[model samples]
Target: MIKNNNIDNIGGMEFATFRLKEGVTETRLVELSHQVEAEFLSQQEELILHFLVRGTDGVYADVAIASSQEKAEEYCQQWLRNKVALEYLELLDKESVNMTFWSKIN
Candidate 1:
């Protein structure tokens, strides 16, 4: 059975945070985001993603996957295989280190 959406200590959540590059219009960005969420991310039940883009500040996402860091990395790679999806965001740091964090609902 599928587990609840809320994150807990038992299910260690890994985060994949990224940012949007300049010149992508808000309308295009949102459209691409919805498509990615529904078509790509939703297909993977092992993943839970939170795409955050408020105003014009920046584009960020907190991706919580139900498995190891390697799986999380694989998921990220798969999500980017879409050409349209690739235009929406970029890694905040090309040299950033990957880390795992716990997620939970208050």
Candidate 2:
């Protein structure tokens, strides 16, 4: 599963956070990160993002990104060998979260 939240312009760059499944390996994650970074560089898009992979056993891996979602998903597909499914959750920005702290948090 993947959770995404859009953050308002930070230094004129967009930001998002993703929560992913834990089955992915460190090597694959790094490869994906590099691919995404390359895509952002090619497109001249400023991206600030991070991913947290939650394992069934509760362990997690964090991957930081500065790229586009298209590139990220492409890497995700490749990492899963085109066999696993991914889910995305909409996330509010930090200001939005603070504004509605009483609401069910993501």
* Tens-digit per-residue lDDT, 21-64, candidate 2: 44545455455555544543233333345444445543434443
Q: What is the lDDT of residue 24 in candidate 1?
A: 52
As a whole number from 0 to 100, the lDDT of residue 44 in candidate 2 is: 34
- TM-score of model 2 vs. true structure: 0.29
As for candidate 2, its clashing pairs are 2-87
RMSD versus native structure for model 1: 5.2
After superposing candidate 2 on the true structure, give the runs of residues whose Cα lies further than 4 Å from its correct spot. Answer: 1-10, 45-106
Tell how far residue 73 is off in model 2, in angstroms.
17
Compared with the true structure, all predictions reach lDDT values of 0.53, 0.35
Model 1 weakest lDDT span, ten residues long: 90-99
